[model samples]
Target: MATGFYTHPDCLLHDTGDGHPERAARLQAIEDQLIGSRIDIALQRETAPLASETALLRAHSAAHVAAMRACVPATGQAEIDADTFVGPHSWNAALRAAGAALAATDAVIDGHLDNAFCCVRPPGHHALREQAMGFCLFNNVAVAALHALEARHLARVAVIDFDVHHGNGTEAILAGDPRVLMCGFFQHPFYPFSGVPPLAPNMLNVPLAARSDGAAMREAVTREWLPRLRAFAPQMIFISAGFDAHRDDDLGNLGLVEADFAWLTRCIREVAAHSAQGRIVSCLEGGYALSALGRSVVAHVRELADL
Candidate 1:
């Protein structure tokens, strides 16, 4: 089981600020841990390209893309919302982040790799079609899923989001599309709060409480996610992988550890093997606490690599 690792130095250029939870150091921590654990050598390392305007437009409005480009400051950071910002190099970083997911989708589907993990920043699950929020710039996983459907011509696809926060942006963009099945468990009554009732039938979003533990998450996946995923039998699977749910992470109150992330990855991988020809593309989302984030990502990737 080959796993392609996609990233770029440009991703580290999206400086969110000194004390911001979503900073370049998050990617640095993951890379450091990958090297420390000797997982870096087993994966295929690739540079993420800049996403084309065509690809970005597939998931975002033209006005929103133009607005994001215009918001890039010449030197300092310009706030998109209270949480989202655009710095000098953020445009390129955002493009690369989205591009990584697109490329990974192509790689996995084309059989260059069995699966892939994109470790870029400016996470995209929160960005809406007409707006950017929740530290997200350009819905990377959403763009990739669209690319797989439109360009690659895949019949059906599944999106699995295990982020602590609801992927309201993804649901907003992908809802009601019969070709896609979106499933996930997120902390309810949390930031951007929008997953209780579900936007559409295709969206199987399970809302966990503030202090939910891994046992709760596991139960949700087993009872809610797995059955629908198997029934969908998608041609590919995309993961909006987030680690902020870790107990050590101050961002959210969920009590998941590295083992929990690995368990979740294994479950997703099993479903993919059974239905999607083992094609999986995972893109990073939210994870604040550095040490916990690094360990959790390594565990997730280890499962993806079957290591």
Candidate 2:
């Protein structure tokens, strides 16, 4: 089996704005890097389907999904927040984003792939169950976790979020769902401040100090996240892999580099190998520096694909 690469052309069509950080070029950068690497392992490229109503319901309310669909303007962009925007293509792109996650989960769990990477826009992490913010329309990782529990009949799943900002949306969606354990490490005192308050016993949210760099991140994983994750002994793993913490990325104060992203992937792989048969699916969340973003994603996916 190979690592599935899940994406769609419509994902690029979800345009933010000319100067927005969540631009289409971010996906282009990742695609270019992957193409340039020539990492020789079977690559399963697939078009992402729209997530089913049932899948959406796993993580979000039907009313929330309906309202998001309704907010899709006929021709122009709708500003959902100071940092969030939805153009005409936004609705379908978000669907594909969440859909790609579900597709990846199914691939790994069904023995169709070793693991998967979802490269889509409107990066999810800040999206709550009902509110869209922080350039996120849907909580992709949470949706994937829910799919694993409900559709795949998995008893327990886990979500590992290594983004610079906390995955407040994922927490909102999956909190108190005993079927899932979520371990998140994010730079503290950042935008959309949350993730420190544990919503459930299954949730392990580790907040690192700003400008802490990779050593601090590694420590958080070793001391905080890894123990909780291993204790939960999840049936599958999902990652909200965000690169905005990269030293070159200006969105956050953290000074992590590509090595940090690769290191985190290695750690996640270790636990997945031990407990979940390496069933891991990663989705793009936030990365502002296009060049660093490209390099970091390549490192992360290279590890996921074991290239």
Candidate 3:
């Protein structure tokens, strides 16, 4: 079967404001590229469901949820942090972003699809359990990991984050849980610099220097992430797919390209095939440059779909 694709129109309606890097145009760029390349016809498409408060509580605090809801503006955008903002539609968009992750997990687990991709906006890896920061309002992948464990009755799961910045929120949420093994690579001394020491035993946080390229990433994966992931033997895999590491993106200096994203995706698939029954649910995290983000997503999804 084709890979499952989940998204929502509300995602595009989450307006960050003028000149914001994380804008609705990012998704449009991706869809335009897929349609231009005719890849959209080869995948299974579904509208994302709204994440319930119960599901949101799986990875977030009720206080946090209430606080974010309170921040929702009735007329214009309200800045939650120095970088994060919430418009009238931001709350629902965040819900749909996380909901897409949960829905994707259910689809993969129920045998409706082998793997799935959630192309929703307002990336989630940076949002902590109690605060929204770094352009993220909800921790989507964390919610999905918990869903696979608690709801789906899976004993073990893995989360792989390859964003340019560390997944501080994901680490905060699932760090000590033995049932979850989180592995990630991010540029050192980058935004939300907390992975340098790696707080949790279940985390395999590999920090690459600025300007490092895919060769360095390959080395990290082969030497660090793959071995740990194989030993963990996850029953399902969750990916915090972030494309800002691409060289063309000005967000960071990791120097990754479309080929690098594709290679890492293939590596993840190999590990999933070995241990996770080939089940993978990937969610978008970050990627600013429109062209690079679109191209990198196509490469990653193409590999995920094996098309």
Candidate 4:
């Protein structure tokens, strides 16, 4: 089976206004790099559908869903928080961003694809059950994980996050669930300031100090994430693929590079092959520095496609 690349044009309509790091240009950069690297022709590309209220309800409160709808502006941007904004098109974009993950999950679970990548936005992993913050409107990976467990009837699933920032919302939603295993490494003492001491036994959050190098990340993955992931033996895997930790990105002080992202993808792929029958779904979470984000995504997608 081929690797599926999912995205939608509506994702570009989510206007964060000027000077915001989480802009539509982020997705453009990745697409430009993919085309430049000629990786575009190697994978299957699909348009993301809009997520239903039923699907959104699985990971978010009905009030949250209603609030997102109520928050959508008919003309200009509406502020959900200091960092998060919703434009006229943001409602559709947010739904599609989340829907891409759901569609990819279905594709992978149905054996139509070996694995998939959802390159949509506004990025998730920061949005909570009732609150939107950190430029996220909904927890995309959490929504997908719950979909896998409930709709697809998967017994076990693992969510892996490597963003420079802790996936606090993901942890909040999935922490105590025994059917799910969530592992991540983030820059601690940083934004959101959670995950130092994990919320639950099912969560394995490794907090790295600012300026920590790729070596430290690798050690944490090998010593912490890998062992727990192997023991859990998940039936499916989901990745909160974030590249903000890249040394060039200013969003965080970590020193990861393209090679580090590739290595992490390889590790996850190996684990997926061993236990999940090679089913993996990765959704874009965070990555600033345009050049680094594009290059890092190319590296990650290349690994996902094994190209």
Candidate 5:
């Protein structure tokens, strides 16, 4: 089966603001690259669905859910936090982002594809259970992970978050759950700095020092993340694939490039290949520099789709 590519037009409408790194053009850049390259793969293209409140509740609180919905502007934009904002189309876009992850999870579980990549926006790794912060509104990957176990009845899942910044929101939601093994490496002492002093046992956060390169990342994946995943033997693998760690991206100091992203995807895929029938669902997290993000993500999806 062809790998799935999950996305929505509404994702582009969730505008942050001028000068914002996570802007509409980021998605456009990706699409442009795909068309420009004419990359051949029987891509199972799927539109994102609006995630239900019940599904949102599975990963978030009623008040928190209501608050985010209420924040959607009628004709302009509403600021949710220091770095987060919502435009008129923010509600639906955020819904699609979270929903795309859920749909990808379902598709992977149903054997429609070996894996799926969610091209989403208003990124979710920074949004907490009750607080929307750091350019995030809803925890997309976490919501999908919860949906996979709670709704789809999967026993165990592993979420490998390789974003430049720590997935504080994902860690907060999935920390204590023994059903999920969360492993990732992020820049230390950065935004929403909480992964250093992790809260739970299932959370394997490898905080790399500033300026660490892709080689260091590979080592962390081999020495730290591999053991936990091998011992757990997850029924499915989920990746919070963020390309902002690329050398050209201004988001963090980690100096990884497109080749590094392809290599990382290969390693993560091996884990899935060995354990989960190659079932993997990866959601876009961060990658700001337009040119760099474009190349890095294409490299990632190319490997994920095995094109």
Candidate 6:
């Protein structure tokens, strides 16, 4: 079966203003690279829909949803925090970004697709249950994990995040859930820092020092993430895939390269094949440097699509 590719044009409409790294051009770069590499040809393309309130409620408080909707300006943009902003179209764009995650989960879990990738912006893993921050409005992966458990009746699930920064919000939302096992590495002593203490017994957050390279990442996966993930024996796997850790990206000091992303994806695939029946759902998170982001995503999708 083809790998499902979920995206929506509306994602570009949620502008972050000039000089912001999380701009619309990020998604364009990924698409352009996929097209240039002909990876798009093998994908099962699907337009992302608007996520329902019921779905959002699974990961966010109703008050949080109402507050975010109120923050959307009728025109121009509204800043939700130092790093997050909402333009007139942001509400719809956020819904579609999150909806794409849910749709990817359904496609993979229902056996309609082998696995899926959600190319979304306003990158999640930062937004909490009650607030938006760090360039995120909704926890897309968190929403999908909840949907997989409640809607699909899956008893166990796992979330692996590999952004340059810790998934503070994802942990804030999913830390204590007995059905979820969250694991990954991030550059510590960085922005929104809060994963050092292993938020909950279920969270396995490894901190990478500044300038740490692919070797460090690989070691963490082998020594920390994989052992816990294997013991958990999740029925499905979700990835908060972030490429900002790339050495080419100026946003962070991590030294990861395209090959590193491929290696990690392959590792995740192996875990899925062992316990999840090859089920995996990956969603785009943070990657600033355009060229690096594009190439890294190509490598990741190549592994995911097994092309």
Count of backbone clashes for each model? 0, 0, 0, 0, 0, 0
Which ten contiguous residues of candidate 5 have the minimum total lDDT? Answer: 34-43
Candidate 5 per-residue lDDT over residues 174-270, each given as its tens digit: 9899999999889998877789888899999999888999899888888888878988999999899888888888878889889989998988888
Which regions of candidate 5 are displaced past 4 Å? none
What residue runs in model 4 are displaced by over 4 Å at the alpha carbon?
none
Per-residue lDDT of candidate 4, residues 1-307 (tens digit): 8999999999999998888889999999999999999999999999999998999999899999999999998887898788998889999999999999999999999999999999999888988998899999999999999999999999999999999999999999998999999999999899999998999999999999999999999998999999889999999999999999999999899999999999999999999999999999999999989999999999999999999
Q: How far is candidate 6 from the true structure (C-alpha RMSD, Å)?
A: 0.7
> Listing every candidate in turn, what is its Cα RMSD in Å to the true structure after a full C-alpha superposition?
0.7, 1.3, 0.7, 0.6, 1.1, 0.7
lDDT per residue (tens digit) for residues 145-177 in model 6: 999999999999999999999999999999889
Model 1 weakest 10-residue run by lDDT: 77-86
Model 4 weakest 10-residue run by lDDT: 73-82
Model 6 stretches astray by more than 4 angstroms = none
Clash count, candidate 6: 0
Residue 228 CA error for candidate 5 (Å)? 1.5
lDDT of 1: 0.94
Mark the regions of model 3 whose C-alpha exceeds 4 Å error after superposition: none
Clashes of 2: 0
Which scores greater on lDDT, model 3 or model 4?
A: 4
The alpha-carbon deviation from the true structure for residue 170 of candidate 1, after best TM-score superposition, in angstroms, is 0.2
lDDT of 1 by residue, 1-307 (tens): 4899999999999988778999999999999999999999999998999999999999999999999999999998899888888899999999999999999999888899999999999999999999999999999999999999999999999999988899999999999999999998889989888988999999998999999999998988899889999999999999999999999999889999999999999999999999999999999999999999999999999999999
Q: What C-alpha lDDT do the candidate models reach, one value each?
A: 0.94, 0.87, 0.93, 0.95, 0.88, 0.93
